[model samples]
Structures are given as C-alpha cells and as structure tokens.
Target chain A: MDIVIYGTVNSIVFALIAVGFTLVYGVSRIPNFAHGSIYVLVGFLTWSFVNDLRMNYALAILLSLTIAAVVGFIMYRFILIRLRGMATSEIIASFAVSLVILEGLRMQGIGGFKGFIGPFYVLRPFIEGKMNIWGVFVDFQRLIIIGGGIAVVGLLWLFTHHTKMGLSLRAIAQDERAAMMLGVNSDRTAMISLSIGSALAGLAAVIILPLGSVTAEAGYKVLIYALAVSIIGGLGSWAGAVLASFVIGFAMKISTAMFGAVWESVVLVGTIILILLFKPSGLLGKQKELEERV
Target chain B: MSMLEVSSLMVFYENALAINNVDLRCQKGEITGVFGANSAGKSTLMYTISGIILDIEKKERMRGGERVTVLGSIYYEGADIIFMETSDRAKKGIILCPERRRIFPESSVLENLKIGGILATRAQAKKTLDYVFTMFSPLKGLKKREGGFLSGGEQQMLAIGRALMAQPKLLLLDEPLLGLSPMMEEILVRAIEDINETTGITILISEQYARPILPIIHHGYVLENGVSVLEGTSQELMDNPDVKSAYFGI
Candidate 1:
C-alpha cells in the first residue's frame, strides 16, 4: 500500500520534470539540455522574489515563469538557431548554457549574498500539512505534485488539439516540411516550443522545489531524472514519457524497499540500460511501422 | 493576369542542375499540368514555385551537404516572390499538397485536417471541412483512423482535402496519382475538376503519367531531362507526335 502511494507520487514528480524536455524534443528534435538549469534558475528566482523582496507569492511565480520562458526563447533565437540541423552541436551548445547558468548560480551574491547554493535556498510550500492516503502519511506538497502533474498533461493535450498555435507545433513535430507547406513556420514554432517548454520547467520547479531544499547541484540530478524517464518511455512521445515515469518510479521505489537506499540510482541506470537494449526506440519512438510500410 | 508565372528558373543541387532554365505559367482559375518522366525536374519546378526549394536550399546549406542554387524569378499576382519564405508563401494562399502524401502518420484523419487548417479562420475551416467531407466521404468514415493505416488512394484524397482546408489560391499537386488504382485516379481527377470549377482555385499539377491529367488540364508543359521540351494546349500536346510516342504511350 505504502509502495503504491509513494511510487505514484514519485512518478508524478518525474513527469513534471520530464514534460518540458519531451515537449521541446517532440516539436523541434532538440534535447534542450538547459532544461534543468532553467528549472533551478526559476526556483531560485521565485525564492528571491518571495523571500528577499517580500513580494506576493503568486505574482512572483508568474514573473519567474515568464522570465524562464523568455530565457528559453533567447536561447533558441541566439544559440540554438545557428546549430539547428546539427544534432551534436545542438547538444553541446545547450549543455554549455546549462553549465554556465548552474555554475553562475553557485557563486555568491546573485539571488543572495551566498548565492543559490547550500541548504539556505529552500522554498516554502503553498500549503504545509499532511494527509493520510492508503494508510500512508503524505504531505500536501506531494498531493499537489500529483494533481498538478496530471493537470499539466491534460491541459497540454487540449492545447495541442484545440488551439491553432498548438496544432501548428504538432504539425511541425510530425513533418516539418509538410507543415511549412501548410503555412506553419518551423522556426517560429520552435521558438514557441522552447518558451512553453521552459515555462513548464519553471512550473515543475515551483511545485517540486517546495518538497526539498533548492540547490544548484540538483539541476544535474533533475536532468538525469528527466532523461531517464524520457528514454524509458520513448523520446518525444508524451504518453510514453508519463508511462515510463510510472514504471521507473515504481521500479526505483521497490528496489529501495527491498535492497537499500543506495540502489535507487543503480535501479535508474539499470532500467535505462535494459530498456535501451530491448526496445531501442524507447517503446514509442516515432512508430517505425510507418517507415517499414513505406 | 496569370495567377503565377515563372521565367527562366534554374535550380542546381551542388553543380548538378535539377531544373535547367524553365519557364512556366498558370493562369487564373485554370489547371496547368507539368508532365515528365522521373528525374525530369517536375517536383523541383513545383517546389521552386511554392517556395519549398528555399527551405531545401537552407537545409542543404546548414548540413553542408548539397549546394542548392536558384536563378531567375517567380511572380505571383504581379509581385516578384522568388525568395519568399515557404510559410509566408503559404499564407499568401500558395499551398503544396506535397509528394508521397506526406500525411502525419500518427495523427488521425480529423486531426490531420485540423493541423492543415492552421492558417484558416475558424469559419473558413468549418466550411472547408464540411466541403472536404462532402467531396471525399471515405475520409468521414476514417476520421479516427491514423493516417499511416489508410490505403494509398484514401491518403491521396485526404492529402487533397487537407490542402483545400488551407484555402489556397494556387494549389500545387505533386504526383497525386502515384501508387493509386485507375479507379482511384478517376475519382481524384474528377475531384480536381470539381474543385477548380466550383471553388475556382487555380491548380498546378506535376505528374509522370500524363494520360488522365492531359485531358483535364487546360494548358500542359512536357518536361524531359530537366528542360521544358514542348508546351502547348492540351489538344496541341495530344496531337504532337513526340508527346504521343513518349507520354501518351499510344
């Protein structure tokens, strides 16, 4: 009972972190290596605005998310655009940006005198309490994480289905040249994708950071978690990412329960390797059947 | 005035000329057909007119793969539009229905239509969708079917309908009859006529098989080895001995 409850919560948290990466990769075929940095950056920015500046919490969240989205837009416009078709260069450039931001936040005096490092960078949760679910005592933050994660996924589906901009993004993801023929500009679509992806990261950070103290190093950990889930589910498939999150979440939790806490990372790496070996396309990668038929 | 005019247009892929100095014109509210055998630059000509060649050129340049060069100009509605972006050109109502029926394989038929209708107003989309369903009733039954699962003929119908959803003034159909049955070809040819006659959208069709297309097109250009060797009215091409032996297969 405890395993199921905790596992579901862990899975939702993973989905939140990975949804941004999945979205960007799906639309533009860019891995968005700066995703984690944007997450941590927004986390610290929201923290500073709420704590140091003593601004309204909701307003600070809105401002920080907007800034994160703009940063993503700038990243694409300035850096990623040059290396658009080169896969290796895209990975390198985005990773460099991530490293710069993460390390910069580690230094003293940007958001605080001591910077965004150490245990001092904790964020207060929206609500501080506990609730019993399935005979397991879980905090309100975990509940919010689960609820918010599902909401985000559902809203994303509706956006892609009903809205013109979102449909254009979907079209670009499917066939860029074909979409362009129908008046969908790939560059503009990619720009919007980056902004939405970054904003999603900011949203994930805001919700998830409250459960633990925010740290610069957490960026790498978040990136790995996002990659792991995306790979396990299948890169660029939304449903795949969510399902893989649940699978890995439970696998990691069950391993921890049986073996020890040290086995968490071991399970993550092991599951990734196993999935790659068996299903190289990550269970839903582009559906090769279509190519085979052609 | 012509809806689209291309004069002395040449495209080279890394020194290999794909389209050797070609001049083509599609008058307003007419179906202009460009017929050729494979490798005759029919697709290249359509791409160049629809501005897809620019995208190809950019991609090739970025990848350091092929060097694509385009010379001369294309005029649409009396304005020089040789270098317009493909999407901007599409916004100006020049939509390409693309080769291979490049439908989104994972997306459903309805979703594919919705995606193609991105540039249209809500009312235009609604009206076009109804018209598409009325014309291609097979699509209505396959609304929930994934695009890849559809047969070649059904995919072609969907491709044409999807293009129509964009409300194009000039519709470029590239090899729409490829890999389809004779019956399916007849249905599509009839639909093409209906679209041009009813909606009055100008069409530029490129095909290797000129049998069905020649009778329907008002004006036709026969391309051989990247060059326009013979061009005249449909009846003139039918009477031309060279076109008769090569394309008519008569």
Candidate 2:
C-alpha cells in the first residue's frame, strides 16, 4: 500500500509535467522540445535564488515563473513564429534550443551537480507523520503531492472548459485557419498558451525540487518520462496525459521494484510502442481525418 | 460614393499575374457580383481586398514596376483602411465569409459564434449571439453540435451566421452558393437578401454561375483571363451577348 501511494504521488507529479507538453502541442501544433529545458532551468533558478541568495520560497517561485514566462514569450516571438508552417524546421529548431539550454546550464556551472534545499522544513513534521493502512505506512509528503497534482489538473480542466480564452485556445487547436477567420489572433493566442504552459512546468519543477536534489541533467530523464506519458495519453489531450502518466508511473514503479531501475525505461518504451501499434492516435486523441472530412 | 475602390490593382503568383490592373468598386448596401472562369483571378481579387495574400512577401514583380500595388485605396464608411491588419479590418466591420465555409469544425456551434464575436465587448457579443440565433433559427437548435458534423448547407448557414455575429458593415462572400442543392441555394439566396434588407449591410459575392447571382446583385463585373473585361448593372450584364456566351451558356 505504501508502494502504491508512492507510485501514485510520483505519477501525479509527472502528469503535471506532461500536461504542459500536451497543452503547447495542442494549440501550437509544435512538439516544443525545449519545454523540458524550461522546466529544468526554472528549478535551477529557483534553487539559486532561494537557497543561494536566501530569498523566500514564495518569492523564488514567483520570480522563476516570471522568468519562464518572459523566456517563453521571446522564444515564440523570435523563433517559433518564424518557423510556423514549416514543421520539420520547427522540430529541428526546438531540438537545437533544448541542446543550447542544456549546455548553457552546464557552462553556467549548474549542471550535473545535485543541489538540495529544505524550504518545506515547516511542513516536514506534519508530512513525516505516517499513516498505516493494510500493513503499509504512507507518508504525508506523498499525500500532499497527490492532492496538489489533482487540484492542478482539476483547475486546468475547469479553466479550459469554462473560460473564454481557454475555449479560444481549443478552437485554434481544432482548426487554426478557421479560428483566425473568426478573429482569433493566432500569434497572441500562441503566446498566451506557451506562457501558461511554461508557468505550469515551472510550478511543477518547484514542487518536485523539495522531494529530491535537483540537477540540470535531471530534466532530460524527466522529459523522456513525460514524452512517454504524452504519447500514451494522446499528444494533444490533457485528460489523456494525466491517464497515461498514472499508467506509466505505476508500471515503472512496479517494474523497478520487481526487476530493477534499468527495466523501468524499457517497460515504458515497450508500452508506448504497443499503444502506437494498436491505436496510433493515442488514448484520448481526436480523430485526425475528421478535419479532412469537413 | 463607393464603399470600396480598387484602381489599377495587380496581383501575381510567382511571376504570373493572376489579376492584371483590375479596377472595381462596391457601393454601400449593394451586392457586387464578380464573374470569372476558374483561374481568372476572382478569388485572388477577394483575397487581395481582404488582405489575406501578403503582397510584399508573395511578390515576384509587377508589369509596370509598381510592385503589385493594391491601388488606389479601399475605404469603409469613408475611412481609409489600406494599412489595417486582417483582424483590425474585421473589427472595423469588414468581414469575409471565405470559400469552403471555414467554421471551427471541432467546436460547438455556439462556441464558433462566440469566436466570431471576439472583437465585440461582452455585452455586445451576447446581443450579437442572440441576433445570430434569430437570423438562423435552425442554428439555435443545433447550438451544441460540432461544426464538423453539420451538413454542407448547415455549415454554410453557420458560416454566414458567424459573420453576422461580427456585425459587419461590408461582407465579402466568396462563392456563397457553391456546392449546394437547388433548394439550399434558394434558401441561401433568400437569407442573404433578408440580411441585406434588414441590416442594410453591403455584400460582395463572387460566383462562377451568374444565373442565380445575377438577379440578386445590383452590379456585376466579368473577369476573363485575369482582367475585368466588363462592368455594368446586373440587368445590363444579363442582356450582354458576351456575358451570355461566356458565362450563361446562352
């Protein structure tokens, strides 16, 4: 039961990361490989500001979010906008940006070194208390992470369903040309979606940093897991991302416990391949040919 | 005075002139129908006027070195609008119900309408939504239906309905009656007339078949091989032997 709870908590955190990937791809029709870099950069920046400069945790998170949002906006304006209508070029450009960011972090002396901070010290005592059920001890941190993840997902679902901007984004995702004809500014909408997505990734980074020491190289691994989640979830769907994250998370944990850590990635890759073979669109993906029908 | 004026306008695609020194005008509250063959630049004219085709980026060269100018000027309510973006032009009441009935296919009918009303204030959007529903009563019943599932005729109605939601002063209809049953075509013609009569909105409709559109338009232009060879009132064009031979199959 404790193992189950741990898997559930880790699944939720990974789901948050996958949601950002799905959101940007859904609206912009770009894979956005640099998204994982943004996530890692934010975590490093937050660590630097809070642990090194002795800033408040709340202030550090806010500053990190702002920085991510600004970088996202500039990237869209200068790079992504020019790459629009060129899918291959856009994917290549995103990959290049990811490499640049990763190397930049290393050159700046923030890569491959595990850095730890205890900003959640106040909540530590409460979280340290264990709840035993069915001969299993569950920690409070897992509960908090699980609850927070669910809350974030719920809030995003509500916003996308109930808000005007959210509806606009969905409309663009469905048919960008039609959305533009209806007076939706594609550039502005893309910028807002990218900003929101980057901020969500940043928030997830902050939440996960306290659970383990963060390093720049951590992002690539997390990104691989997130991509697997995204593929299993359906590339452009929020609900699919969440569901896939849980499935992969649980599978990975179980596989790691039974076999070893090395088998976890192998299991994930195999599942994704099977999913693609059976249902190429992913679990929650809308019908691709429906657009051609109209 | 004309609501929109184009003089010596030239359009090209990779060194090939699609519209050559075309001159046209649309009067207020008048339906100006453009008649042309498939590649005679009818759609190109509409796209240029709507500012969809970027003249600068898509340019090769103009015949007279004018560099593919959209001369002399386009005016809406007597205001110069040559420099406005497509979205700004939409906000200023110039709307395009483009060919293919480009509705947001995955969105519900109501959501599609809301997208069209993006430029309006919240209160105004609500009012426009109500107005659109009234204009197309069938849309009110199918407000929750995804646009992709709608029939061709229904999608056409939704497209026109969406444009109405924008409260357009000048509406550009590119092939409004294309690919419709005879009954559907009649209904569309009547609906367009009703819109013009009630709202006093000016409309420019381009059509290959002049039979159905000639009776509805106030004036018409006949484009042949990328040039405006004929221009007159609808009745005059209907009687022209050249028009009869080229378009009407008389």
Candidate 3:
C-alpha cells in the first residue's frame, strides 16, 4: 500500500516536471532548455512576492505564473526566433538563457537585492494535512500533485482536440507548411506554445516545490529529471513521458525500499541507459520507420 | 479580369531553374489546368502561386541549405501579392490542397477539417462541413477515422474537403490525383468540377496525366521543362497534335 501510494505520487511529480518540456518540443519542435530556470524562477518569484513583498499567497502565485508566461514569450520572440531551425544552436542558445536566469538569481548586488542562495525559501502547502489511503499516510500536497497532473493532461487533450487554436497548434506540429496553407500562422503558434510551456513549468514548480525547499541547485535537478523523463519516454511523446515517469518512479522507489536511498539515482540513470540501448525512440514514441512507412 | 495573373515568374533552387519565366492566368470562377510530366514544374508553379515557395525558401535560407530565389509578379484579384506570407495569403482565400494529401495523419478526418476551418466563421464552418459531407460522402463514414489510415482516394477527397473548409476563393490543387485509380481519378475530377460550379471558386489544378482533368478545365496550359510551352482552351489543347500525342497518350 505504501509503495503503491508513494510510487504514484513520485510518478505524478515527474510527469508534472516533464509535461511542459514535452509540450513545447511536441508543438514547436523547440527543446526549451530554460524550462528548469523558469520553474525555479517562478518558485523564487512566488516566494519573493509572498515573503518579501508581503502579498497574498494566491495572488503571488498568479503573478508568478503570468511573469513566467511573459518570459517565455520574450524568450521565443527575441532570442529563439532567430535560431529557429538549427538544432545545435537552438540548444546552446536556450541553455545560455537558462544559465543567465538561474545564475543571475544567485548573483549578489543586483538592484540591492540579496541573492537567493540558501535552502530557506519554501512554498507553503495548499492544505497542510495528511490523508490515510489503504494504510498509507500521504500528504495533501502530494495528492494535489496527482490531481493537478491529471487536470493538466485532461485539459491539454481537450484543448488540442477541440479548440481552434489548439487544433492549429497540432496541425502546425504535424506539418508547418500544410498548416500555413490552411492559414495557421507558424510564428504565432510557436509563441503561444512557448508561453504555455513556460507557464506550465511554473505551475509544476509551485505544485511540487511546496514539498521541498527552493534552491538554485533544484533548478538543475529539475531539468535533469525532466530530461530523463523525456528521453526515456521518447522525446516529445506525451503518453511515453507519462509511462516512463511511472517506470522510473517505481524503479527508484523499489530500489530505495530494497537496498537503500543511495540506489535511487543509480536506478534512474540505469533505466535511462537501458531504454536508450534497447528502444531509443521510447515505448510509445513515434518511430522514424513508422513515419516513413506512413 | 483574371482571378490570378502570373507574369515572368521564375523560381531557382541554387542555380537550377525549377520554374523559368513562366506566365499563367486563372479566370474568376473558372477551372484552369496545368498539364505536365514529372519534374515539369507543375508543383513548383502551384507552390509559387499559393506562396508556399516563400516558406520553403525561408526554411532553406535558415538552414544554410539551398538558396531559393523567386523573381516574379503575382497579381491576385488585381493586387500584387508576390511576397505575402503563406498564411496571410491563405487568409486572403488562397488555399492549396498540397500534393500527397498532407492530411494531419494523427488527427481524425473531422478534426482535420476543423483545423482547416481555422479562418472560417462559425456558421461558415458548419455549412461547409455539411457541404463537404454531401460532396464526399465517404468522408462522412470516416469522420472518426485517422487520416493516415484512409485509402488514397479517400485521402484526396478529405484533402479537397479540408481545403473547402477554409473557404478558398482561388483554390490550388497540386497533383491531387497523384497515385489514385482511374475510378478515383474520375470521382475527383467530377468533384473538382462540382466545387467550381457550385461555389464559383476559381481553381488552378495541376496534373501529370491530363486524360481525366483535361475534360473539365475551361483553359489549359501544357508545361514542358519549367516553361509554359502551350496554352489553349480544353478543346484547343485536345485538338492540337502535339498535346494529343504527349498528354492524351495518342
């Protein structure tokens, strides 16, 4: 019961972290490397608003998410737009942006603001209580993560499948020229994607960061976790991402329960290596052979 | 005045001329056909008129790949829109049913049409959806089916239906009958005629085999190696010895 409950919570956590990354890549073919920085930025922004500015907690989160979205729009419009098609340059440029944002947060003497360098910044949980499920004690925040993950996935499905803008986004994803022929503007869709992706990263941060402290190092760790889920699930494959999250989540949990906590990272890395060696495209990923056959 | 007028149009991909100094016109509410063999620049001409070439050109430039150059004047409804963005052109009612039926393979047929209706008003989309079903009844049954799984003929039907969803004023069909059976070809030819007659939409259709298409077009142009070698009415093209021998398999 404990394993099942905690494993689900862990999987949901991974899914939340990687969903934003997968969305941006799937829609616009852009690997937004600043995803992690955006996550950390939102956490810090919300913290600063609530603690430093003494604003309402809910209002602070809303403002933080909005800022995250604006950041994404600016990142794509100003920086990534120039380096659209070149894959290597895209990665390098987005990574550079991530470095600037993450490192800048820790830099001293920026507008008389002290650097966010400690493990003291933490988001208060939405509801501070524990619930018993099948004899397993699970916190409300973890339950909220599971609910939020499901809601995000469901809402995204509806958006892509039903709404006009969402349908255009999918159309562009499949074939940009074809979409354009039908009047779907590629640049607009890409900008919308980046904005939504950044906001999602911020949403994940606020939902998950409540469980732990917000640190600059957490940004890198979140990015690695997101990347691990993406790669193991096959990059840009949503169903594959969710599946890989569960796979990694359970593997880490089982290993920790059996051997020790030290085996957690080992299991995560080992699973990624095995997936790369065997099915590099992922279990549910769209295969090149299938694309050619179609 | 013609719905679209192209004058001295030239397209080059790194010094290889794909379309060379070709001029063509599509009269309003009339069917215009361009007949050519493989590599005769039919698709290139379609891309240029629909402004898809600009996108290809931009992408090529971005990748440091081929240097695509286009020199021409395209007057659509008396406005020079040579350098208009493809999507903007689409918004102005220039929609291209691309070659190979580039339907959203992952999307259902209904979703595919809905996506094509992005620029349409709500009522227009609803009416067109009904009209598409009436025109291509096979698509009605396959509304929930994934586009990739449909047969080539159905895909072509869905492609045209999808284009209609966009409410195109001047429709461009690039090799719409590329790999279909004779029966499917006939069905599409009839459907094209039907769309032109019912909606009064100007159509510029390109095909390698002119047998099924030549009968429907009011005016026809025979392209040979990137140049418009001959231009005439359907009867004129069919009666000409050269067009008869080369295109009609005489």
Candidate 4:
C-alpha cells in the first residue's frame, strides 16, 4: 500500500519535471538545458516575492511563472535563434545559459542583493494536511501534484488535437517542410513551444517545491531527474516519458524501502544503462520510423 | 496577365546550375505542365516558384552544407515574391503538393487536413473539407488512419487533398503521378482536370513521364539540362517528334 501510494506520487512528480523538457524537444527539436534553471528561478522568484516583497502568495506565483515564460521567449529569440539547426551548439549554448542563471542565483553580495543560496526559500502548499489512502499517509501537496499532472497532460492533448494553434505546432513537429508548405511558420511555432515549455517548468516547480525547501542545488538535481526520465522513456516521446517515470519512481521507492536510501541513485543510473544496452530507442520511441518509411 | 510568371530564373547549388535561364508562365485558370526527366530541374523550378528554395537555401547555409544561389524574379498576383518566405508565400495561396507525398505520418488523415487548414477561415475550411472528401472519396473512409500507413495511391490522394485544404490560388503539383499504377494515375489525372475545371484554380504541374498528364495540360514546356528547350500547347507537344520519342515512350 505504501509503495503503491508513494510510487504513484513520485511518478507524477517525475512527469511534471520532464514533460516541459520533452515538449520543447518534441516541437522545436531543442533540448532545453535551461529547463531546470527556469524551474529553480521560478521557485526563488516566487519566494522572493512572497517573503521579501510581502506580496500575496498567489500573485507571486503568477508573476514568477510569467517571468519564466518571458525568459524562455527571450532565450529563443535573442540567443538560440542564431544557432537553430546545429545540435551540439544548441546543447552547449543552452547549457551555458543554464549555468549563468543557476550560478548567478548563488552569487554573493552584489548590489545589496544577497544570493538565493540556502534552504530558507520554500513555497507554502495550497492545502496543508495529510490524507489516508489504503493505510498510506499521503500529504495534500502530493495529491495536488497528481491532479496537476493529469490536468496538464489532458489539457495538452486537447490543445494539440483540437485547437488551430496546437495543430500548427504538431504539424511543425512532425514534418517542418510539410508544415511550412501548408502555411505554418516554423520559427513562430518554435518560439511558442519554448514559452509554453518554460511555463510548464514553472508550474511544476510551484507545485513540487512546496514539498521541501527550494535550493540552488535542487536545480541540478531536477535537471538530472528530468534527463533520466526522458532518456529512459526515449527523448521526445510523451507517452514514453510518463511510462518511464513510473518505472523509475517505483524502482527508487522500492529500493529505498528495502535495501536503503543509498541504492536509489544506483537503481536510477543502472536502469538507464540497462535500457541503453538493450533497447537504445527507449520503449515507446518511434521518432525515426516515419523517416525510414518515407 | 498570367497568375504566376518566372523570368530568367537560374538556381545554382555551389555553382552547379540546377535551373538555368528558364522562363515560364501559368495563365490564370489553366493547367501548365513542365515535362522533363530526372536532373532536368523540374522540382527545382517548382521549388523556386513556390519560394521553398529560399528555405532550402537557408537551411543549407546554416548547416554549412551547400551554397544555394537563386537569381530570378517570381511575379505572383502582380508582386515580385523572389525573396518571400515559404510560409508567407503559402499564406498568399501558393501551396505545393510536394513530390513523394510528404504527409504528416503520425497524424490521422483528418488531422493532417486540419493542419493544412491552419491559414483558412472556418467556413472556408469546412467547405474545403467536404470538397476534399467528395473529390478523394477513399480519404473519407480512412479519416482516422495515420497517414504513414496508407498505400502509395492513398498517400498521394491525401497529399493533394491536404494541399487543397490550404485553399491554394495557384496550386503547384511537383511530380504528382510519380510511382503509381496505371489505374491510380488515370484517377488522379481525371481528378486534376476536374479540380481545374470546377474550381478554376491555376495549376502548375511537373512530371517526368508526360504521357499521363499530357492530355490534361493546356500548355506545356519541355526542359532539358536545366533549360526550357521547347514549349507549346498540348497539341504541339504531342505532335513534336523529339517529345514523342523522348517523353511519350513512342
């Protein structure tokens, strides 16, 4: 009962972290390395607004997410647009942006601004209480993560499947030239994708950061967790990302419960290696099938 | 005035001329065919006119792959569109049904058509959707199937149907009858003639094997080694000894 409840919560958390990363990759073919930095930035920004500026908590969240989205738009328009097609440069450039944002947050004593360094920054949960489910004690924050995860996925599906804007994005994702031939602008779609992706990262941070304190160090960890889920699931495969999240979530939780907490990272890395050795494409990754067929 | 006019068009990929000094025109509400074998620049001419070559040139330049150069003026609806972006050109109703049927493989047939309708108004999209269904009746039954799974003929139909959803004013069909059975080719040729007759959309079609589309074209140009070697009405092209021996398999 404990494994089932905690495992599900853990999987939803992974989904929340990686969905943004996967979405950006899916649409723009950009592995947004700054995803984690944006997540952490939102957390710290929200904390600063609420604690330092004495703003209302809900208002702070809205501001932080908006800033995060704007950051994404600027990142694509100014910096990344010049280096669009070259994959290695994209990775290096985005990772450089990630380093600047993450390290800049940890900078000390600049212009009377103390850096966001320690575990003092934490977001208050929407509701504070514990609920018993099948003899397992799960907090309201975890419940919120589950609900948020389902909502995000469902809304995204509807957006891509039903709406005109979303259909344009998907058209660009599937075949860029074909989409352009049909009048869908690739650059515009890619720009929209980056903004939506960053907003999603901000949303995840606001929901998940409430469970524990927000720290600059958590940025790197969140990035690695997101990478792990994407790699195990297959890069750019949304359904694969969700399934791989459950796999890693259960593996980590079961290992921590039985063997010890030390085995958690070991299991995560081991699973990635095993999947790479056997099925390198990830379980549900079919990105290249269409190309080969054509 | 012609609906589309290309004059002195020359395209070079790293000084290897793909299209050289080719001038063509598509009169409004007439089917214009450019017939050539492979490497005769049929696709390049189509790409140049639709402004897809600009995109290809940009991608090649970005990747440091090939240096593509285009020197020409493409006048569409009385405006010089030589430097216009492909999507902008598409918005102006210069839609291309690309060679080999580049449908969105993962999307359902209906979704592919809907994506093609991104630039269309709701009423326009609705009317065109019904028109596409009626014209390509096979697509109506395969609405939910993914495009990649369709057979070659069905894929070609979907590609043409998908292009029609964009409400093209000057439809460019690049080798529309490539790799299909005789029956399928006959159906598409009839469909192309029907579309041109009923909708009055000016069509610019390119084909290597000219026998199938020759009967439907109002005027035709024969290309050889990146140059427009001969041009006349369909009757003249059919009567030309060189064309009959080379393209008509006489």
TM-score of every model versus the real structure: 0.98, 0.88, 0.98, 0.98
Q: Per-residue lDDT tens digits of candidate 3, residues B1-250?
A: 8989999999998999999899999999999999999999999999998888888998899998999999989999899999999999999999999999898988899999999899999999999999999989989998899988999999999999999999999999999999999999888999999999999999999999898899899999989899999999999999999988886668
Greater-TM-score candidate between 2 and 4: 4
Candidate of highest DockQ: 1
TM-score (C-alpha) between model 3 and the true structure: 0.98
Instruction: Supply candidate 4's per-residue lDDT for A121.
Output: 79
lDDT of 2 by residue, A1-294 (tens): 656877888789889788887888889887777788888888888877876689886788799999988877887888888776566877788778877877676673355553433333211122456677678776666666777788889888777765778877887887675566556677788888888888888877777666665666767876787778888887787778998988888887888888989997798888889888987878776654244356
Assess each model's interface with DockQ, reporting 2 decimals per model.
Answer: 0.91, 0.34, 0.89, 0.87
- Minimal lDDT window, size 10, model 3 chain A: A283-292
Tell how far residue A198 is off in model 1, in angstroms: 0.6
Over B23-80, each residue of candidate 4 has an lDDT whose tens digit, in order, gives 9999999999999989999999988887889889988999999999999888999999
Per residue, candidate 1 scores C-alpha lDDT tens digits across B1-250 of 8989999999998989889899999999999999999999999998998899998988888998899999998999999899999999999999999999999888999999999899899999999999999999989999999998999999999999999999999999999999999999999999999999999999999999999999999999989889999999999989999988987677
DockQ-based class of model 4 = high
lDDT of 1 by residue, A202-232 (tens): 9999999998888988899998898888888
Interface RMSD of each: 0.6, 4.9, 0.6, 0.7
Candidate 2, residues B1-250, lDDT tens digits: the string is: 8888877777666567888888889999888899987898888787777766543332223222334444445566677666566666776778888888988877789878877776677887788787777777888889899998998888999999888877788898988888999998888888888888888999998888778888888999999888999999989999999988876788
Q: Find the 10 residues in a row with the least total lDDT in model 2 chain B.
A: B55-64
Restricted to chain B, the TM-score per model reads: 0.98, 0.89, 0.99, 0.98
Q: How far is candidate 3 from the true structure (C-alpha RMSD, Å)?
A: 1.2
Please tell me what DockQ candidate 2 reaches: 0.34
